[model samples]
Target: MSLVKRIRDISVATLNDKIENAEDPVRFIDKYLQTQKRKLTELEKLYQQTLTHAHSVKQQFMEAESNRIKRENQAEVAVKAGEEQLAKLILLEKMQSEEKSEQYRLLYEDGKQTILELEEQIQNLKDEVQELVDKRAFYEAKIESIRLQKQLNQVNRFIEKQNYYDQSRSIDQKFSELEMQTNALREVRSNDTKTGSSFGGKLQSEVDAQFQQLKKKLEKER
Candidate 1:
């Protein structure tokens, strides 16, 4: 295996574990996402550089191959024209071109492989960042739900307290009404007693007058 075949792998296991075990998941996820984004940016830049280098190497290889083919044809033409020395020189150039072409070919292949690995790493980084974003959203929603529930509970307690107050007020009003009725009954009894005393005095006076008349008539008869 070529040394270029070894690409650094991106790992998110530690970050994921930290996020899962964090006391403040929201804050942890935010920081983790930012870090992942920065890493992704660096990896993307590296991938672009690798791709450019690979293209340059491929171009060089193609140029070298074309030169080799041209030199081969030139060498053949020189030999046919009875120019032995010139043909020898052209053959040497062709060999050099072949070597150069091979070297560039190897370089281009290595660059391409490196680019592939970098792309994979970049994709993984992106995936991890996206996962963190989703987690952040989930945490935000959960927090909102908790806030709403708390508000609902508070409102329920307020309503219960208001109902209790209203009931107490109602009982107080009923008690006041009962007290007023008792006072009115006492006033009526007092008025009835005064009227009965006046009627009894008038009856006693009439009886006394009738008894005196009967006694006076009996004395006259004696």
Candidate 2:
């Protein structure tokens, strides 16, 4: 399937190939894991079938060899019993059993080789699938980080493109103007505080002089 091809192309050996703009790397990896897992199951079933075949071949080879030995014994007994015709028949049967055993032996050996190859394939495929399963979280998290970094880069570009620095300057200018106004207000309050104290002293001195003049007039009348 295309998923197999896609996943296979992401080489861990070569650093050149990158995980591209896959919308979801997890889904991509999962598709591959699922497909390979199916293949692994099929391989195991075939492995079992080959094992059964190999067992059958071995059994056939053993049976033929056993028959050959039995015929040889019978042929010796026949020859000792002075039965030449039966001995000849038994010898012929032994020869045929010997040939059959040889053929079965070859078949059994070939079956075992086939089983070995299939076992290797199954194990290799199983290991590859498991590696993907184990590394799934790591790759997914890395891809997510890449996606966020890309967005952050885009945001920084937009800020530069839209002249956000000028906006920042305008905000700074407003704060500066606000600070100046505050300073002006503080100076005006300070001046008013000093002027109010002087005016209070002058008014109090005038009231005291008027009170002294009224008391002198009352003393002159007495």
Q: In model 2, where do residues sit more than 4 Å from their true spots?
A: 1-24, 147-222
Global lDDT for candidate 1? 0.86
Residues 103-139 of candidate 2: C-alpha lDDT, one tens digit per residue: 9999999999889878777766776777777667788
lDDT of candidate model 2 versus the reference: 0.85
For residues 113-213, could you state the per-residue lDDT of candidate 1 as single tens digits?
78877877777667668777888999889889999999999999999999999999999999999999999999999889888899889999999999999
> Residue 51: error of model 2 in Å?
0.9
Where is the poorest 10-residue window by lDDT in model 2?
12-21
How far is 149's C-alpha from truth in model 2 (Å)? 5.2
- As a whole number from 0 to 100, the lDDT of residue 191 in candidate 2 is 97
